[model samples]
Target: MEAHRIFFERPFDYKYAREYSGTLMTPTLWITAAYVILVFGTKAYMKDRKPFDLRRPLQLWNLGLALYSGAAFLIATKEILSTWFNKGLTATYTDINSFYEGTCGAWAYLFMISKYYELGDTAFLVLRKRPLLLMHWLHHLTTLNLVLAGYHYDTHLYSWLLWMNTFIHTLMYSYYLLASCGYRLPAGFAKKITTMQIIQFCIGLSILAHIGVLKLFTDREVHCNWRMWWGTVFMEILYLTLFSHFYYVSYIKDGGKKFVRDQNEKKQVKAQ
Candidate 1:
C-alpha cells in the first residue's frame, strides 16, 4: 500500500472518540427533547409578538456556520480523496483504519460535536418569526441524535454522510448568509438548493444499497453495522419523501407562480 500525506496531523484516538460519543448518547437525547419543547414554546410565545428585526445577528450566525461548513468540507474531502488516491475506493470502506485511525477520525469527532452548535439555527428562525416548518425543526433534532449515534457506533458509513452533509451545509448556509445580507439570487435558485438536497438523499440511498449488496451477495468484508445502516436508510428515505413533497408543494404543484411572484417582488423592492 502506498502512503499518503495525512492532512490531519494530530494523532487520532478512535477509541476515545467512540467512547466519548457513546457517553453523550443519553445526554443528547435529553437535550434534543428539551430543544423540541423549547422550539415549540418559543414559536407559541412569538405568535402574537411583533417579529424582532434580527438582521445583523442572523447574518453573523449564517456567516459563521457557512465558514465552518466550508472549512470542514474541504478538510474532509482532502482526507477522503487522499485515501482514495493512495488506497483505492474500497479501502476507504472496508479498511476500518482508514476512517477511524486517520486524520478524518479527528474531524469526524468534531463534526459530531458541531451538531450541537447547529441547533442555534432554529433559534434564529424562531426569533425572527420565520415560518418554521416541521421538517426544519425535526431535521435539527434528528441530526443531533443521529450524529451522536453514528459516532458511538463507529460506523465507517459516516464518512459518506459527514462528507455529503458538510458539503450541502456549506452551500446551504452560504445561501442563507447571502440572503441575510439583503442579496437574493435569481429566481429558482432556492429550488435548486432543495433539488441538490434531494439528489444527495438519493445518492446516499444508492450507496447504502450498493453496500448492502456487497455485504450480502459477495464475499467482501464490509464493516457497517446493521442498526446504523438501517437507521440511515430509514432517515434518508424519510428525508427524500419529505423534501420531494416540499418541492412539489413549493414549486411544481402550483407551477411556482406564487414563489416566482414573491421573488420578483423582492427584486423589484431592491431595485427601487
Candidate 2:
C-alpha cells in the first residue's frame, strides 16, 4: 500500500519546491509556435514531392502510442479510485471549492507534458503527405493549450478530461495501428471510430455545460474559474463542430459516394 501510494504520486515535487512556475507556460508557448512553423514548413517542402513510404514507422508509432495511452488510462483510474476511497481526500476531491487539491495533480502535469509528444502524430501525417484537416491539427493545438492551462490553473475538471482522452486515444491509436498495417476490421469500423470521437466531445461539453447551469441558473457557487470554463466551452464546441464535419465528409459524403462512383466506373470499363 505504501509503495503503491508513492508510485502513484506526482513525480514533480522539485518543480514545486523551486517555484519555477513560469517554466510551464513559457515553453508551452514557444513549442506551440515552433510546431506551427515545422508543420507548414514540412508541408511546403513536401509539395510536388513523392510521399514517404512510412508504413513501418507509422505502424510502430501507433502501436507505441496505443500502449502509452492505455497505461495512462489505467494509472489515472487507479489514482482516482484510491483517492475517492479515503474519506478526507474524497471530500476535498469532490468538493466544488477545492478542486485544485486533487492528489493526482502531478499526473495532470504529466498529461500536459504528454500533449507535446502527441504532436509527433501530426509530424507523421505531414511526412506521409496526408491531409492535415482542420479537425486534426486544431484539435491537437487546442488540446495542448487547454491541458497546459488546466494544469497551471489547477483546474480539477481536467482529471476527468485526462481520463476520457487517454481512454479514447487508446481505442483511436489501436485503430490507426491496424489501418496502417493494411488491415481492415469491417465495413463500418472507420465510421464507428469517428462516432466515438464525436461522443467524446459531447461528454466533455456536457460536463462544462452542467457547471454553467449550476453557476448561472442555480444557487451554486461553482468555485472553478469562469474564464477557464468558457475557454473549455469554446474548445469543446469547436471540436464538436469540426469532428462532425469530418464525419460527414468521410462516411456520408465522400466515402459512400466515392464507393458507388468507383463501382460504376468499373462496370463501364467492363462493358467497353
Candidate 3:
C-alpha cells in the first residue's frame, strides 16, 4: 500500500516532465537497449542448441498478460466514463487533473508501465527460438517511448489512445493465452487480431491528424507538446503501414496458412 501511494497515487507533474526526469524514461531507454543486444546475442548463442520447451511458462505469461490487460481496460473505462458523466465530456480530455489525478490517473500510469511487460512477449519468443518478426520489437520499443512521452506531456491524446490500446491488448493477450497452450483457436483468429490492431491505429491516427489540423487552422496556438505529438503521429503511420503489410503477407496473399503438425501436436503448436 505504501509503495502504491508512492508510485501509483502520485499524479504526473509537468514540471518534473520538463526534461524527462521520471522513474520510467531512463529505465525504458536502458532496457530497450539491453533488449536489442540480448535478442541478437541470444539468437546466435542458441543457433546450435535445441529449442527449450517453454509451453508451461508461455501459458502462464500469456494468461497473466490477458488478465492484466482486461483489468486495466475495465478500470480505465469506468473512471473515464465517470469523469465524463460527473464533470463533462468536453472537460474529460481537456482537463489534466480530471483525466490524470485519481483512480483513472493510476490506471493511465499503469497502462504505460504495462508496455514494458508486453515486451516480455518478445523475450519469450527469443527464449523459445520462435520465428521472430523485427516489427514486433520495433513496435514495442517505439510504443514505450511514445507512451512515456505522451504521458509526460499530459496531452488529451494519450488518454484516448491509452483507453483504446488497453481494449485491444485485452483481446490480443487473450488470443496469445490460447495460442500459448497450443490450442487451435478459430482459424484466422490471428489475422483478425492484426486487423483489429490496424483499425485501432487508423482511429488513433485520425485523432492525431485532427490535432494537427487544429494546430494549423486555429489562430490561437493549440497547447500541445510538440515533442510527443509528432513522434506519436510518425509512429502511428509507421505501424499502420507495417501492420498492413504483415496482414497482407500473412493473411491475404498466403490465405492465412498456419503451421502443420500431427493431430495431437497440432493443438499444441499451431494456433495463432
TM-score of each: 0.89, 0.78, 0.84
| lDDT digits (tens) for residues 1-272 of candidate 1 | 11122223357667766766777788888999999999999999999998777889988988888887888788778877877889878656554465666656677777888899999989988987767888888888888888788778766767877888888889888888898788756666788889989998998898888888888888877777788889989989988988998888778876877677767766765575
lDDT of each: 0.79, 0.70, 0.72
Compared with the true structure, what per-residue lDDT tens digits does model 3 show for residues 65-94? Answer: 778778878877886788688876544444
After superposition, candidate 2 runs with Cα above 4 Å error: 1-22, 81-106, 216-223, 258-272
Residue 63 Cα positional deviation in candidate 2, in Å, after optimal superposition: 1.9
TM-score of 2: 0.78
Candidate 1, after superposition: displacement of residue 112 in Å? 0.9
Candidate 3: lDDT over CA atoms?
0.72
For candidate 3, give the lDDT of residue 59: 84
Order of candidate numbers by lDDT, starting with the best: 1, 3, 2
User: Where does candidate 1 stray beyond 4 Å?
Assistant: 1-10, 94-96, 261-272
Residue pair clashes in candidate 3: 182-267
**What are the per-residue Cα lDDT tens digits for candidate 2 across 118-168?**
989998889877668778887887789877776656466676678788888
All candidates in order of TM-score, best leading? 1, 3, 2
Record all residue pairs in model 2 with backbone atoms less than 3 Å apart, i.e. clashing. none
The parts of candidate 3 lying over 4 Å away from their true place are 1-5, 8-23, 83-96, 219-223, 254-272
